[model samples]
Target: MRRLTLLVLLATAAPAHALDLTATVLANKTAYIPPQCYTRTEDAQGAVHNPCQTCHTLPRSPNFVSDPDLQQDYAIPGPALENPWTNLFVDRRAAVAATDAEEIRDWVRADNYLGADGRPVLAARLDRLPPEWDANGDGAWAGYRPDASFAFDDAGFDHGPDGRMTGWRAFAYVPLPGTFWPTNGSADDVLIRLPEAYRQTSDGSENLAVYKANLAITEALINRADVVIEPMDEGRLGVDLDRDGSLGTATRVVFAFAPLEGVTMHWAGRAGTLGPKVAPLAAGLYPLGTEFLHSVRYLDPRPEGVTMAPRMKELRYMKKTSWQSYAELEEGALAEKKEDADFPDRPKQFFGSAEAGIPNGMGWRLQGFIEDAAGDLRPQSFEETVFCMGCHGSIGTTDDSTFAFPRKISGPGAFRDGWYHWTQKGLAGTPDLVRADGQGDYAHYLRTNHAGDEFRSNTEVISAWLAQGDLTPEKAVALQADIAPLITPSPERAIALDAAYRMIVREQSFVKGRDATIAPQDETVWRRVEQDAPTGIAEPADPWFYRLKR
Candidate 1:
């Protein structure tokens, strides 16, 4: 159920602590204006609609944010990391009022918001939908999104054949009980807030209401901010300063979405095409067929099921491709090539080249791995309980109950297993790792909690239970406090819904990529942005580079 509550919270190992997370990492540059749009295109008729909010709040599907011949790759705040105490809300602004700090700055960089006396400001709209949140009523609009009708069904994931839509993906993570990211893959204390199109009821998904949005670390601290934590291992969790102004030391931030390896949701189809001969993209860029519906904006496709129709040509995107503005992720790194399907790193593990079809959503931000290295964790880098294996361990299937893959790694590596460790590019297998049934204890073995059923590598039963050592720090603190609240993430999942929330915390029918995700590469780049992403009362800088350990 819900991914076995996300593998029992991915077998708890997060000991490190020191989280103020500066109002959830300055609510990650919040400001996302996508008030609505779901079109079936039969002239438009399925449900949900906003047609475009007078001055732009949400009505450009595919997540629209265009007009960037290139403003730092599409800027709105995406590549981020120029630093100003984490650039404090980037260009900040967009607060007419709709709380939880404007849904964490509209999930950051959608445009930056928070003006009205709160401080760091910039956004300007105000027509209807804000008469003061009907309270307990039904009129709804306290500001989360999805009012106009609400239709979410991309119809059997279209494809006209093998071109698009096989759809169905979910993976949510804003679970804040003590929220904090960055074990060491390095998106560094990541923060992103999307929520605004969901009112749907005609059988779509998120009609609304998830609940929980705190943000008050003394508002973010300029004075009363004291913190300390760093334990690492049990899986992972860490921190020691960076609450904004301890100034450099363990400095860390990480996140890496893996639908399976690298990224690349390709399709370039129509519009004077550059490489649409069918596939093989990368060169000069250009290939988003029909400008990709509403125009190439990076991430805006929510059909989940049923609506499918528009499959040939429509081209009308003077803007909105990959729909720019999470401040464009800080400033670069999303040419969208599905990141190239990554998993084989043991030394290059036997080479690449195997792409083909179906993909276009689910970049779970590579689930988890971030290390600031001041002490223990950070061996090569991979902390934070592997962040739920980015999608229950990148599917490709494993945890083998019987169906195997070690005859020497075939097919998707025989449907994957041993949670991936391999090692033989130039012949590296001996103790080089390739485990699957060594015994068990990989901090508590996973694979959606072994649901794919037949798993084996318990590292020789945790090395014969640490060599019959009768381990007990109160039995490892009561077996990690009974699996830490069962799988943390409740506060109503830190409230903030726009449409899809993803609950599969655990499911392992050999997920070795059966339902894949982790996509990103589509192709489109220009980038130039300099400043302007803050919005929520900016003004706070000190981090010479992460601190709080001494």
Candidate 2:
């Protein structure tokens, strides 16, 4: 019995429960459009590329204000423009998103070009986590790669099941020659979007590419996900369910994450002019980096001694309600930016400040980290960080954003690396704050105007053909950029975006473990054939796929 006792004591216990990483497909309160292509060209590129200010000529440009359906092809995907060989004009454009444009593109450069080498040059992206994520109460979180998978599903993401890949086409960031929507899926020629000219629209009006591609923004990286089509409904889109979705709604996407920390922040309120004060922050209030009336620990909660000034007030943080609802959030966020002390250097240096209290040894590392991370994402795009960080709102459901973050996940063994979960310390769940509009002036936060040049309309330019997004690129045509119309943006595109979102989510969510093995649903829908694309592409399968009867 003594020996048995000794063995029991010495015997290692079975691994404690695995961290419950239930990567549920949650919706963001705000949605954004990824500025389609990620490239760096001077703001002047628009002129050189189009020479007519035609790319930005909205409502219409080439011929003047035009309708999306006027052409057969849709918008161009980012891939086509990455190469100057194919997109010769892209090289002449000036570098506006120079730093970020290069960083984001370089970070995933391998994904751009194909090589004879066996290794695939692509970002093996994990699940989508919030950016600006802060754990350990550090007032900041860094980015890391996660191990996750994405899949395209039919149940939730089938837009047009077994539909012929005839009329669908991929447009170029380059200009296209003619319209081709109902014909073969070929639109490499009609029109293009200026990705470099992307200005953070205050009203969410310009987030076209992000919203369209379901990438939140052009700078966002595609993780392990496969796109598919699905039935669309009003409920999924927060529309009046009673109303008929007369609009041919597209599919809802389903995404699965290995559940890494994405854009997350943990701020403890510190409200005090001089002395400590405890107070509640109002909902929908954002903490201006200014001395607020509350003591809120944003990254870490020092609940023991943390408090605002004698008259300290709570720091209220608002988050985007849904990605589709980003319009509202952007309005709010943009308004807020207009009110703040336009501190350009703040985003990169905020957390490392002495007030933020970096632990002794971690200070240097923290500073260096801020330098590197800020340079990578926020240095040129504070609003992007704010826009991203805001949505991945507070950890758990606490009245005050300050609460104890669970220390471990799985076990000490699991956390050997950075695999810790915020749930182990306590319950409300880990920080998953949402983005709020008016968080920062879009361009000011990013400081992309390093050249001291006019930053208005700094975005990438697409060839006119991509505007249609149909037909084969080889057979695609290019039109002059000046002729298109200034698009007022109708509900049709919005509805299509919602449909695309549905398709991306449902497809990914249903096939959680497949990894990035599956291609995008749109890819399947159009059978996007590009000279740059790989050959012998296999046809994708649909879950509820129907075999049409003759």
Candidate 3:
């Protein structure tokens, strides 16, 4: 009865935008900081009572600066090309008041925070965090980590008897929404610059050439900061929130770059290979096969019964070892081997081996790719891992360590949307291209509605849905039938709606009994085969490239 009253008071006292602190209670607070190791008090029952303050004596004040070692060094004030803005709070000060300090310590105990090493950033360290590190201005830090106290199932990805996905659920990302990443195998708009070695005409030249051309446009937009990466899992798969299906299965990220100076995107001369279509956006005519800055690919285990959202108790993090790449996607086996020791750091343009063990944490590695002139995709130089790190390495952007969410507007507004607006207003006179002062259409929405927690994603919405136990396949099919009538008739709307339904129906039976497949490999596999074993195949390159060779 006493506990219930305290909980009620805590709930009511919490700000509407504040995170639900129910999970803040320490089940075994002494386990986190051993009583013998710190100061303690003995009760009449002879039990020792140790408070959190014993080891958490480091005080974070308003003037403290975050240590460089604790943060990723990526582009600050990230690219903001779209969205509605809001007037969210921005506090980077260290906790001085006893109440603030105690509340922050609770975040550490709940596995709801993290630092550069993937462990929960100790409460003492919260004050040193940069505002970007705690973008949502919440008292506790961001980065929903999975520690021993928050253990999860690691039997996934159909590994051999000795293999287990020990770190599959430790998901994290860089919270840079301005620079967006697109879902894998979806419509790509960001492109890259191809090195001379890949542009030559030879046995495997056609696809490379096509990718080169496609990347030209991507390069143009990236340099101009005009790309916009949208989310793929919004209001889909029998769920109203984004990332409901995405956080559990499959690895996809989209980054949309918005340029300060309007961009002029268009297809290359060989647009026929990309399907003979032209689409324009903002101020550019986009041809087929356009690409983005880089891609972060991982061998996802696609585990069953795992779900996440903001402020949920059963949160998980994506482990670093499961990460892989493309564009700059090096070859498998060999690339993986090379990357094992030199993860997030490898020789550029070299293909080598990968890691083969349960990683200590998440590396957020990705296989990047770009399109060719003939509208074909090509693997990036082997060193493409750095391309992804260049932007995502920012301090405190740890939710998947990539700057993308499964869908936009999953909750009131996703993380930092409000902060972005506030920052825009704060820097109204700055000449910065990426962080230009302006307002998006959703700024008003951001001001009025908010997800209420910084460490939130689409997973929060799904958690509520799952709590109701209405996620069965039969229910999914029924919901699909129910939604069919409500779906509008427009082609664009219908396509999105249909995609969502299709994904939900397909994923309903992920773990019922089947071998899990690896995520899609980069296009370089074919290039290697064509280059090495040309005689075994009738064509050495894509049909378009083969014709070009003729």
User: Pick by TM-score: which candidate is best?
Assistant: 2
Alpha-carbon TM-score of each model against the true structure: 0.17, 0.20, 0.19
Off by over 4 Å in 3: 1-361, 406-408, 412-550
lDDT of 2 by residue, 24-98 (tens): 121211111112111222233332111111111112100111212211122232332222111112111112211
Could you say which candidate leads in lDDT? 3
Give the RMSD in angstroms, all C-alphas superposed, for model 3: 26.9
| lDDT (Cα, tens digit) per residue for candidate 1, span 151-183 | 112211112122322121111111111001101
Worst 10 residues of 2 by lDDT: 290-299
Q: Rank the candidates by lDDT, best first.
A: 3, 2, 1
Give per-model CA RMSD: 27.5, 26.5, 26.9
Worst 10 residues of 1 by lDDT: 178-187
